[model samples]
Target: MIDRRRVLKALSKYPVYSPPFHNSEAVLSRSEIAANYNYFLEQKARRLEFLASYLRHFFVELSLSPEALPALDNWLLRYGGHLIPNGGEVLFAMNDYEPAWVGEYHGVNIIHDISIFAGDYIVMKNDKVRWSVNYGDGTKRDYEEIGFGQPCLVGLSHFAYTGNYSIFHGIYEFCYAGLRRLRNGGRGSKWERDIPGELVRRLNYLADPDPPPQIPVSQLTIDD
Candidate 1:
């Protein structure tokens, strides 16, 4: 059986995260930022092996039998109950988006977004990468992240959007789990506290570890 509580406990230990400290002088210090980046790199070092193993095994299992893959209905029933409530409940929720392989970079996959926004590229070697060239949105500073946007907390130039679609897909799963936790037990009839809580939790970079509830929630209303 899945130990949800234990999973939450493990998730709580993610690195301390905050909004992009845009004005912080330390953002320019490659040395200081490098220090924090190294810390995050160390943490990633530990997870990389396990993730690689899991991905390798997943492909192996899928190759063994394509039928082993769960259908969309089963996927939703298993985890989509509360996360995707409305139009999101539909299959292929991201049908509006498209992924294109623009070219190869140093033998890595260079995926470009064509149909969506302006167009950005993700050049990933193997299963990981440290940076990319993001030309789609000028508002988001860090298209080239140091370590999955962990550096963004310090006012770094770019938020960390790493890997490829796989990593983005993984974030969706984590968000789903966060929504699951928000529900009182597994009964996610409707969103109450969990909606805002999940959003804030996602902002803080730790879905399991709760953030300090001191300011934002009190001032804003649904109408705002």
Candidate 2:
């Protein structure tokens, strides 16, 4: 069981940010020089814990058993795509991974985090990323090269909201679906490879040119 009070208390503090992310680079550097070296480390651990607890809270609230959830480390190692800093927000690769973080910016509390799902068919063509389409607005954007650990927003995302269980549940279902597909010898797309099940139904849908027409049961001829 997660302590909601603990999470809320942590959120009450000023958010700490660091390198390979947004403004955290400076924070990390400054802390390393001025503050105790362990200060940043402590902050990092706190952030990870709060985020994990936040997700766990939702899992329980949605009636999902704790056993049904994978360990955070295992989950991230398996499906964690990449983390990229966008302005003041950090974007996570997988759908259900987004967690709420409270930070102080210019004397105000700000929540920073996001989740991005790329296109099903995005590919690199001619030294440029082709087939990249915004999953939300359907707009297209091109990128020459994506940096390591940087986010590519060639798809849609639900940005910076207190966790929504329905969305998480949907992702969980896709992951479960991917597992079932894997058991049946189906391979997922590059993005789906880590999390597997998202593309199974989509691929099946695309494979069939025409779906059988529906007929009313009353119109069926009786064999007997």
- Stretches off by above 4 angstroms in model 1 are 1-30, 50-122, 125-224
TM-scores of all predicted structures:
0.27, 0.24
> In TM-score terms, which candidate is top?
1
Q: Global lDDT of each model?
A: 0.28, 0.29
Summing lDDT over every window of 10 consecutive residues in candidate 1, give the lowest-scoring window.
106-115
- Write candidate 1's Cα lDDT for 121-205 as tens digits: 1111112223321122333544333222232211121233222223333334433544465454655545432333332233223
The 10 consecutive residues of candidate 2 with the worst lDDT sum are: 106-115
Q: Write the per-residue lDDT of candidate 2 for residues 1-224, one digit (tens) a residue.
A: 03324334444544434332332222213332233324333453454444444445334221112232344323332322212112342222221112233231211111212111111111111122222211122223211111112222222222221121122222333434444444444554455434533333332222233424445566675532
Best by lDDT: 2
For model 1, what is the C-alpha lDDT against the true structure? 0.28
